[model samples]
Target chain A: MMAKEISKSNYLQIDPWENLRSLSKARIALGNSGGSLPTREVLSFQEDHAFTKDAIYSDLKEKELLKHLQDFKLPVYQFQTKVSDRKEYLKRPDLGKKLAETSESENGDFDILFILTDGLAADAINERAIPLLKEILPKLNDYKIGLCLVKFGRVAIGDEIAEKLNAKFTAVFIGERPGLSSPKSMGIYTTYEPRSETTDERRNCISNIHENGMSIEKAADLLQYFIKESFRRKISGVKLKASLPNQIDRK
Target chain B: MAYKFTLRGKTYSFKDLKTVLAKATPERSGDALAGIAAEDNKERIAAQYCLSEIPLKAFLDDLLIPYEKDEVTRLIIDDHDTEAFKPISSLTVAEFRDYLLSYEVDGKTLKGLAPGLIPEMVAAVSKIMRNQDLISIASKIEVVTKFRNTIGLKGHFSVRLQPNNPSDDPKGIAASIIDGLMYGCGDAVIGINPATDNPQEVSKLLKQLDDFRQQYEIPTQNCILSHLTTTFEIIDKAPVDLIFQSIGGTEKTNSSFGIDLKLLQEAYEAGKELGRGTIGNQMMYFETGQGSSLSADAHHGVDQQTLEARAYAVARKFDPFLVNTVVGFIGPEYLYDGKQIIRAALEDHFCGKLLGLPMGCDVCYTNHAEADQDDMDSLLTLLGVAGCNYIMGVPGADDIMLNYQSTSFHDAMYLRKVLNKRPAPEFEEWLLKMGIFDDQGNRKELKEQMLKLK
Candidate 1:
C-alpha cells in the first residue's frame, strides 16, 4: 500500500476578513496556525513595537530643528526643564513641567509665544514641528510672536516660559505619545494668559497631526481659528467651544 | 496617630494612616513620584509589619479620606455591612490575610464576607501578602455577573473583543469584530474606545455596534467608551446596552473626569431604565488604573494601589457587570516596568475579587514603558490561573486607536487552551452553533467560520 500523503497547509487557517485590511490600519485578518498568530504577523508586530520604542527614546535633533526654526525669521531661544535626562524625564513628569533654575529667561512683550518641546516621543517633534510651524507662523504675522524650544519639557512647561515672556497667549507644539502605527504624530496645545498654575481645562488641544492623521496644513488652520477666536473672546479651552457661523454672532 | 515599627534595631515611623499605607505599598514609580514611597526595602518592610498589627475594624474607624469631605469615603462608610463583617471583625490585617488563604474560606464564604470589608482593609492585607498569596486567594473567589450571558463562573474565561478603530469607521470595526469572533473571543462584550468624544460621532459608532450585534444575533452587549455625560445625552436616543465610565479613587479625581456620585447615580439609573438586558441587568461597565488619582492630582497623600482598591469600592456600589483595571496603560511614571505592572495587576485583581466585583485586566503596556510582550504573556498566564473574569481582545495585541498593546484574540485563545477554560456558556453554545468551536470546546478550523461571518 502507498504511504498516506498529508499536506502542511491543512494546519494554517486564513481568515476571510483578510480582504478587509484595506479599510483600516488596525491589525486584523492575520491568519492563524492552530489558534496562534502566524510567525510573520507576530514578527511584524514585534518589529513595529521595536520601532515605537526607538521613536520614544530617540533624541530631538536640536541642531537640525534649530536650523529649521531660524528659517521662520523669528528669534529662537533654547532652554531646559528640571529633568536631567531621558530616564529622569520618564520617571518625574513634575520635573518635566518645571523650568530649570539654571536656564535663563527672556522677558518680552508679545501677543503669542510659540513653545516647542520633546514630549514622550522626540521623533514627533524632530519631524513634524517645523512643518507645522511653517504653516502657522505666516498666519500669525500681524501679532508679535516669540519662539522658544526647551529640552526634556512637558506641555505645561510652555506656561512658565510664556509667563516669563509676558505673552498674552501661548501655543505649544509637543510630541504626543507614540502609537504603534503613528510614531511621528505631533500635538498643539494653545492656552490664553498662560501662567505656571494653568490647568489642562484652560487650554485647547489639536492632536494627531501627522501625515496619516491630521495634516500640518489642517492643524495650522485649526490653530489659527482657535487663536483668533480665543483672542477675540479672551478665552480658551473647554469654555471656548467651536462656534459655527450662525453661533458666532450670538456669542 | 503616628505608627512605628522596630525592625532589625531600626525604627521606621509613619505620621498618619495615609503615610503608613503609602509607605507599606510595594515600590512602584508612582509613589516615588508622589514623594511618599518608603525610603528603602527595610523601611517598606517596617511599614508592612506595623500595618499587619492593625485590626481590620480600625479601617472603619480611622478613614483615609475624611468621610465628610469625600463622597467616596462617605459611601464606603455608609455602605459598611456590620452584619456581614461579624465573621472577621476581630482579626488583624495579618490574620485576615491568613484567613482569606485558608481552605475554609471558599467562594461562597468570600461572597458573604465581601460586604463587610472596605477597600483599605483589602489593600492593607494585600501589602503583607506575596504574589502567590494574591493569586491563590483571588482564585477561590468567583464574582459572577450577567447582562446577556453570565460571566466569572468557575472554569469559564471571557474576552471583551475591543475592535477599536482610529477613526471609528464602521467597516474597520466590523472587520475586527469578525476577526475576534472567528478566534472565539467576544464572550464578554464588544466595547469600542472611540477616537472622538463628539456626541454625534459617539452615537454613530454606538448605533453601528448595536446594528452589527443585533444583525448577527450574537449573545453579547456593545458599548461606546465615551465620557459618561456623552453617554447620558445619547442613552435615550441610541441603543445603549452598558454605560461605560473611567472612575478614579478620590472625589477630586472623579471631578477631573467630570463626574461625581450624583452624576454616576444618574447614569446608573439611566442604564437600568433602558431595560436592554435579557438575562440580567448589571448595566454599568467601569475601567480603572492604579495612578489615575495621582495623575489627576487627587491622590491625597495616599498610595496608588490603595486608591485603586477604593475605586473598586465605587464600582461595587453601582453593581457593575464588569470592572477592568487597565493596568500598564498608565506609563512607566506610574508602574515603571514589567515587574511593577505584573505586581499591580495581581494586587488589583485580588483586591477587586475580594470586594465582590467581577474583575478583569487589560494585560497591556505602552511602548515607552520598560516592558515587552513576554511580560504580557507572564501576566496573562498568571491572571488565567487566578481565574480572572476577562481580558481585552484587541486585534493582534496592538490597539492602533489607543496607541498601546493589549492582550489579543489569540492570547485569549491561548489562555483558554492552556487552562482548559471555555467561554461564557451562552457564548460557547453560540460558537458551537456558528461552527467556531466543536462540542469538545476545542476551536475548529476558522476558514468556514470566517466565511460564515463574512
Candidate 2:
C-alpha cells in the first residue's frame, strides 16, 4: 500500500557548511579534554552493576555558559508548550525550557537533577530512559530529594533550569535525532557539578538504547561513571577529554 | 456543514493531509472522490482518535526505500543489527576522546565473529550495499521498520506506534510494524508479524494495506528477495501460515482451508457477478516451516497436524496467486536434527501435482538460527537433487563469504555478481549467495522439479 511522505521542519540550509563542520569534527572531537579524569570512588557497592553499554547517548548543552558541578540529581523542572503540533515542538524549543508552575511547586530540591523529555521520537523514552531512571534514582536516594520528575514535549536541555536554580549538576533523558534505522532511540546526558549556567559542551552522553542498540542497564552505569568522575575532578568536557583512552567503542 | 475533529495523540495526520489536500484539489464532484477519500479518512480518524501516536514522517521516510527499489529482488541483512551493541558515546569533543577509551572490551578482537556491535553493524551493513544495490536487494536491517507505505508527499516505512501504556492500540502497532518492514526492506514484498491477537485487527491491517495500495504508487515488491521476504508475509498470515510453522498445526483464527475456501468462493461469485474478480489474482503464498517437519509420516504433532491441515486447506481453498515450499531438508543439520525435506517436498509436490495448481519447491536449511553453519552449506548443493524448483534461505546463513560467482542458480548467481563487492562477507553471502539467487533467479533442475509439482 502507498503512504505519504510528510515533511518536517529542518533548516538544512540555515548554515549548511557550519552544520557539516559541527556534525563532523566538532560533534566528534573532545574540546579541551582528552578523556582524562580522576578515578571515581563508589561510596557503596549497592550502586554498582548499573547500566549496560547500548543505553548510552549525549547532546550539546542548550545554553553557552559553563560551570563546575558539585552535585547532580534533578529538579531541573521540565516544561513544554501546551501545543501538540509537531511544528510547534520544533519551532518553540523555548517552551520546552521552562518549568510548569505546578511542576516547580511539587518538585523538591536536589544536589542533582534529571529531566525526561520526548525529543524527536517519544516512543524511545522507555527503551532509553526507564532503566537509567530505575538505576540512578535508587542510588541518588542517599542525596537530597532528586530533581522533580516531570515529562515535557521537546528538545531543550537541563541547563535552562540549572541556570535558573543555580544547581550543581543537570541530567536529562531525551530522544536522539531519529535515524533511518533508529527513529525511536533514547539518550541521557549529565554535567558534573553543574550550575544553571552549564552549556551543552559541559556534559557527556549515552545513546542508542533500543533492543537494537545498548540496553538501559549499561546506560545507567555509564551515567553513574560520568557523575562520579565529574564530582571527583570538578570538571567535564575538553578539560577531561584530551588524554583519556586509546579507543572509543560506541559501535 | 459538519466540521471534522480528529483524535490527535495517536494518528500520523494523513487525515489532515487528505483533508487539506481535498480542500485544495476540489474534486470534480464531491461524490466522485468520496470512496477514496472516505477510506483515507477512516485510517486518519483512527490514528487521531488515539491518545498517543507515531509521527507519520518517520514511517514515510522508511517507506521510500521500498518504493525506490520496487523492482529489485534481493534479500538484505543490515550490519546495523550487530552495530547497536558498541560501547561508546559523546556530546562534546572531550567526551568523544573519553568515549574512545571509555572501557576495555576485555581483550576482544575486532576480527572473527563474536557478538554484535551497533556502529560496526551499521557500517558493515552499509559496506555490503552499493548505491546500485539500493533497488536490487531486499534488506533486513535491525531497526524497527517493517514494510512500505505512503504518508504524505512520499512513501516510506511506517513508524511504530508504541503506547506508553499497554492498555491497547493493536491496529496502530500492527500498522507501524508493517510500515517499518516496508521501509527497511528493499523493493521486495514486505510483511510483519502482527503485534496483536485480535482477529479484527488483522482485518484492519488488510484494510490499511488496501488503503495504502489505493492511495499511493505500489510497484510489485517482489524480486530475488521474494524467496525469503516472502516468508515474512507467510508468517504474518499465521492463522494461515502457522499451520505451516510446524507441519500439521492449527491456530484458532486462520484456518488455512477455511480462508482459502472463503476467498475461492468470493472469487467465483465476483467473477460471475462482474467482468473482473480476483480468481488467482487476489493472492496466496507458499509457506513451510523449519525443516524438522518437512517429512512427516502423517500429520502427527498436535501442532504439526494443525499446520498440515491448515496448509492443505489453504491450498485447496480460494486458490489465488499461490506457491508452496517445503524445507530443503538435505543439509547436514537435518542429518543431526530431523528435516524430512525430501519427504515433505515430495508430499507437497504430490499434492500440487494432483491439484494442477501452483508448483511446490524444496529448500535447504540455511539460517544459523535454524541449523549450524556447515549444515546449511551442505544443503545448498543437494537442492538440485531434491527435484525442487525453489530453495528458500538467506545467503551466508551458511558460509562466511557470499561469492556466488560460480553458481548457475538464478538468485544465487545474480546476487553473487550483484553482491560480489559487498564488504560484509558473512551476511551478504548468506542472504544472497545461498538463498534468493539460487531459488527464484536461477536453477534449471529446480525448474524441472517445479514442473513436476505443477
Candidate 3:
C-alpha cells in the first residue's frame, strides 16, 4: 500500500516536517485504550436539510438548538444572521456574520465561541456537520462556552462575526472545499480569538470529519482532546497530541 | 520484491501493508523542527536538503537555532531559486483569536483585538474576492450585449482630455472626450485619455468630465468613462480628494485615474494617507510593436518581474494595490509576440506572485475572425488573463462610433464593459435579479439566481 505509485526520493520526503532520528517507530499494538469517545446520534446525508439554515434565514430563533447543545456543556445562545445577497455576501463578508437579530440586540459573555457554518458546500454540512456538532456539543460543557451562531456559505463569514462577538477561542465548523477525493468533508477552523481579521493558518482545522473519511464519533473525541491540548500547549495543527496517560490501561 | 520509499532522508522498503508498517511507522522525532534536533539530527538535514548552498544552509541554521519552546515556526528555505516558504503564516488563528479576545470594549477587553487583526482579514478577503469579481465581470459582459452590438471608443491615447469650462459646467467633457455618452455604444473599454498635458488642462478636463456625467446622468452602465491621467498634472499641488468624492452616481461607481506607483508608495510610507484604494496604475508589460515592431529594450518592453516591483513594495508597505499593466498591443499586426514576457513573469520568484489579475502575453488572439462585436472583444479580452485594463476598439469599421476619433467608439464601449466588469452569461437575468438599476441595491431577491449557474 505504501509503495505502489510514489518513487523512492519523493516518498523519503514524506513526513519530513516530523522527526527522523527515532529508530524505534511505534506500531498500534493490538491494544489501544479509549480516551473520551462519543455516542453519536448519527444523521445520514439525506436526513437533516430540515435542521439546516442558510446565509438567508427568514426568521432566526436563538433558543432553538440550545438545550440539545446545552447538554454538551457549551453555550449555544449566539446566532448570526449570516444572510445577505450573494454579491455582498462575497465582497463584504463582514456584514454576513452579524449576530442573529435577537442576539445582536441582547448580549452574552461567553469565551471562545463555536460557530457551525455551512460554507461553499452546504450539502456536506447538511449531511455531516450537524452530526459532528451534535457529538461535540455535549462535551464542550467542561470548558466555558461562548455564544455561537452557525452560518452557511463561505468560511470568511466566521472572521467578521468572531470580532463582532469577542471570543477567546472561536471555532467555525465550515465545509471544506470539496476535493476530487471527497465532497462530503468537514473541517473545524478554531482560532485563538475571534476577529474579522483572523487567517487560515492562525486557526486550527480538523478536516475529513464526515462520512467520507473519519467517523463522526472519532472526530468528536479527537476534537475534545484537541481542545484540551490546544489550551495546554497553546498551539495546534501539525503539532497537536493528547497528553500521555500515566497508565496505559486498555478498556 | 520490496517497494522502497524514502522519508526525511531515510529510505525504507515495504513489501506490502505489513512491511510498510514494519518499515515506516510514525517514528517520534523528539524534535519537531531541525533547530531543536539535538545536534546529530540537524547534521543530517544539512546533508540532505543543502545542495552546494551555504547561505541556504546558513539561513536555515540561523532559523533553526532560534527554536526555543513556545514560538511556532514551520517552514524555512535557503534556496533562493526555490519558493521561499514563510515560517509563520501572515496571521495564525491562535494569535488572531487571542488578539480578538483581548480587544477593548467599554473599558473591558473585547477579546484583546487590535489593528494587527487587519492582515488575516485582508488575506481571507482576497480569497473569496475571486467569486465576486468573476460575477461582476461576467454580468458586465452579458449586459453590454443587451444594448448596441456595434460599439467603439476613442479617447486620449496618451494625454487626458478636459473641457474648456470650469464653474458652470461640472460634467462637461474635455476636448479629448467631447463625444461623451453619445460617443461609444456596444461593448468596449476605450480609455478616455483626455490630452490634458498641464494642470490647468487636467483641471478643465476633470471639471468637464464631472459636468458631462451630471448632464447626461451617465449611468456607469452607459459604458464610456473618464480615465483621468493625473500623474502628469501638478503633483506638488491640488486637492485630489475632491475629485475622488464622486462615488455617488452609483454606489460602486468609481471615478478612475492613473497614478505613478513609486509616488504612491512614497506617499503611503509617509503615513496613513488616503487615495490608496482608488486611482489605478499602469503596470509594466512587454509590449513592442512587432509587424509594426520595435526591439525589446528596458524602456520599450517590461516583463512581469519588472512590473510587479513597485506594487509589491506598495503592498509590503500595506498600501492597497490598484493598477493594470499594458501587456498587449494592437494595430496592423495579426498576433502579439509576448513569449519572452510571459515566461519571465511566471518564473520570476517575487514578481506576479499571488496577484489577482496577471494576464499572459498574446491575451487576445484569433485576429478578430468573429465578426460579431461581442465575439471580437471576448477573444481579445482573454489576453488580459484578468490583468491590465483591456483596451478595445470599435468592432466593424464605424468611425461614427468613435465620433470622429481615429478609432471606433462602438468597439471601445463593448470592450469597456468587459474591462469595467466580469461579463455574465445572462446579464438581463443578473440585472433583474440584482435590481441593479434600482435606487436600492436590491440583490436580496436574486440570491438563488446568482448561486445557480446557468
TM-score of candidate 3 on Cα atoms, chains taken together: 0.29
Residue pairs that clash (backbone atoms under 3 angstroms), model 1: none
- Model 2, B1-454: lDDT tens per residue? 1123354443334333223222222111111212322234454334223211222222222221142332110011132223422332212222322222334321132221112222111111211222222111111111111112111011111111111101113333223222222111112222323322123433344454445433433322221111111223333332221111211222222221122233334433442332211211323334543222222211122122112323443343434233444443322222222233333333343333222223334344322112322333343333322222223322111111110111112222322233222211222232243222232222222222232211
Local distance difference test scores for all models? 0.87, 0.32, 0.31
- State the lDDT of candidate 1 residue by residue for B1-454, as single tens digits: 8888999888888999889889999899999999999999888989999999999998999899998889999989999999999999999999998899888989999999999999999999999989999999999988999999999999999999999875566777888888889888998999998754556777778888888877778999898997787788888898899999999888888887778899999999889988899999998999999999888788999999999999998999899999999999989999999999999999999999999999999999998899999999999999999999999999999887777899999898888988999999999989998888887666676664446776
lDDT of 3 by residue, B369-443 (tens): 111223234434442332332233321211111111121233333333444432222322333443321222111
What DockQ does candidate 3 have relative to the true complex?
A: 0.01
Candidate with maximal TM-score: 1
What CAPRI grade goes to candidate 1?
acceptable
* Isolated chain B TM-score per model: 0.99, 0.31, 0.34
Cand. 2 TM to true fold:
0.26
Q: In angstroms, how far off is A223's CA in candidate 3?
A: 2.3
How far in Å is the alpha carbon of B63 misplaced in model 2? 44
Give interface RMSD for all predictions: 6.0, 26.1, 34.2
Q: Which stretches of candidate 3 lie over 4 Å from their true place?
A: A1-74, A91-94, A97-111, A137-141, A153-166, A179-181, A235-251, B1-454
Once superposed on the true structure, which residue ranges of model 2 sit more than 4 Å away at CA?
Answer: A1-78, A81-84, A92-95, A98-109, A126-130, A149-155, A178-183, A193-198, A238-251, B1-454
Where does candidate 1 stray beyond 4 Å?
A1-6, A73-76, A103-111, A137-145, A167-169, A201-204, A221-251, B448-450
TM-score of chain A of each: 0.90, 0.57, 0.56
